[model samples]
Target: MKIYKKGSLYLTEGGEMRDDLINIYKDAPAIFETIREEIGKVVVGQKAVVEQILVGILAGGHILLESNPGLGKTLLVKTIASTTGLHFSRIQCTPDLMPADITGTTLIEEVEGSKHFRFEEGPIFANIVLADEINRASPRTQSAMLEAMQEKQVTVGKNTYRLEEPFFVLATQNPIEMEGTFPLPEAQLDRFLLKVFIDYPSPEEEYQIMERYTGHAEPKVERVITRRELLSLQQLVRDVPISDDLKRAAIKAVVSSRSWEGVEYGASPRASIGLILASKARALLSGRDYVDRADLEVMARPIFRHRIILTFDSERRGVTTDQVISEIMKAI
Candidate 1:
């Protein structure tokens, strides 16, 4: 692997693209469109949100989804899992939820008149795990997810269990200001590759939603791409090329956040890496062979929003993290 560095950003070149990768790259756009269409069968709108989720998936990273209630955040994850043919499991987080509830507990079993310990896997063992209302879970419970999100494995007592291939933790949370919510720490939040914000649908889309859900017939979607194909595309996404100039711009955008006017703290080096990877994914999704300025601009906010912290003055003035990130982008 060839590496390029500027500041903390390091770009690893996917050496020698094979014929299979070329075919996959050529087919990626149509497949991605089919995926969006399948998801649209169940979900009404939020095209940008869906695309960002797909970017996270292609990059093989975890996602943190935020929105008000009834925005179909949970439905989005389920639809993605179904359409992609990945094993799906959901964890409804609550205050009383324990660590063992998310990562399996060890149980004692008797076999051949002998007692032995057996580890019964928890919901985290699935290909795609949905942690709904993650903020409702206690801090201790939230910590249990860190290893799985970052390392894609669970350690129970003395044993370690490896998660299956193409694993992802799609966690949804209500806004921090909402009641009964515990704010996630910076370290934990950094583990997420993208922080997607799902907005309310338009009046026309809401009408369509009511029409679909109110009737006797329920909306369903067929599988768009198989697991093996998706896994292949994930590898191909990394092979998408990025120009050195755009790479430096991305690094500058993230590094500038440290001293940005409203920011009390800036994003870490991981943000730089995520921005590049997500840009490559976005380019591949659009059927482009290389990353462009548009991809970097579009991906900057979601990659940096959750990583930065604003000063109290900025918060009092009702300024958001997105605003700060946009400022940094413009300056760069």
Candidate 2:
């Protein structure tokens, strides 16, 4: 592996020694490993899920987690914030949720015998935001998040409020419920960099979970990285070098998702860009300076699963989006 001063990594032919990208690669994994260890203190099992979430963070993108209730979706976000030492805020989406309920509102307040309007920042202003059960909110309320998710700024009234740096939104939705939930529009779904599906833990992991939580025992979690360190890491991730070949491969994988058979709509250009950035982060997490085909291939499913829409034929035949994605991966 070659570590470059510009934060670009390259793999050597022998895979024994890095030429110029070794320094950049060395600093990336320590931050990730420390975060993993800290989160492990509180969260049990689902290690892959946690790592993928970290990848999303490193990629500087939002994540949408789909799972049933009580799978620790909310806890996972909270634990991530705690472990990474970032400010955390949560917004519970409901039928009556309003735009201002998330992005903040202007209020008139008396100051020195004079009334003036001031902007009060909402939960979305924090470094890490957990939009719990986001699908339950109405379309109007949900659309309010569009600008913030895409532009990293919330427009209220005539003024726009720029969100803090290193910002991330980890939204969760209940997969089992449909009656009271409003499905996220396709445009809104495209904003997420990755859609992670949280599943049940294994038998042994479940046993460990039970034993750990029995009799009012609490899991100990420590903060591993500070806010400054996290911001620096995010900047470093952006500086990581990606070759044109790997970049084109990422684009090809995302393109394949849309044009595949039995697909109504494929991923958008934004999805392609997201895949490239996410693959870089994933490679960095594995202590590799350069991104390989394996990184892009492994990340294709999560990066494009939610972005693609299935056709009626595929849906009627019990074909899942993930299954179609697997086929696309094989074809690619």
Candidate 3:
């Protein structure tokens, strides 16, 4: 349990420092499985989607979940909060939602017969925040999240408050409903580490969902990890290494997207950094201490899909961002 001490030296079999590495490589997956098992008990299936969310968490990054209604975008994030033993808060985004609604606003209060202004913290203070139907909110309201996500702090009336450690924003959006839904600005989209696309469940999975739901005794999930342990895992993931060749390849892949025929805009340099971080998290989830080439390739899609924009001509031809990313993957 103390394997994560700051500077303690640990040696295995040959008295090498590999024990620390071995601990992460051997233990991370079991820890991951512990949470996945809990999630599987209630959530029918979306194994890949679940894994990508876990990758985002381990990478200490925010996630944007997009899918049509009833695909369980809400349920997935709520489950993550319950299983991780983290405090959860939700914001129902609307055109009427103001910056003060998400962040704290100063209010006058009377204490000890004296009137003074105090800052009232908002829902963004929790460890896990679900911004449901975020695109439905006006762009001005959406812009309020900019500072909170990037700085991990909310500023109001010249005062700033730091968010809790391990804080994560899991925002949801309905891809098909564009009426009155504001497309997230590029800068806002870039702030998210990965955009996870959810698809409808498989037939077999749908049957299980039906059976599990119609029962009198519904499913319950136990907390699989504590806040402290989750923080440690995030640190452990960052400690994983990558080779120069893989680094170059990742950059090359991102750079190639810039001039690709169908793309109006390509992923920025942030995509390269996100690609590396996410791949390392993937490797750690597989109980590996070093990221492999396969890890880089597997993470490319989720990290780049939202970052690139398809041209109007490409849209007219039915070209999609995912297809463009697929081509880049093959060439690199």
- TM-score of every model versus the real structure: 0.94, 0.91, 0.93
Collision count of model 2? 12
Report the C-alpha lDDT of model 1 over 181-202, residue by residue, as the tens digit. 7888999999999999998899
Off by over 4 Å in 2: 4-25
lDDT of each residue in 1-332, candidate 2, tens digit only: 34323345453443333342344345667767877888887688888799789889988999999998888899889989988778899999999999999999999999999999999999999999999999999999999999999899999999999998889989999988798999999999999999999999889888877887885868868888777666656655655567898786677777777678899999999888888788878877887767888877778888888989999999999999888877877776
Q: What are the lDDT scores of the predictions, listed in order?
A: 0.89, 0.83, 0.88
lDDT of model 1, residue 91 = 100
Compute the lDDT of residue 179 as modeled in candidate 2.
89
lDDT of 1 at 147: 95
Say which candidate scores most in TM-score: 1
**RMSD (CA, Å), each prediction:** 4.9, 4.2, 3.4
TM-score of 1: 0.94
By TM-score, the better pick of 2 and 3 is 3
Candidate 1 Cα errors over 4 Å, as ranges: 1-13, 16-20
Better of 1 and 2 by lDDT: 1
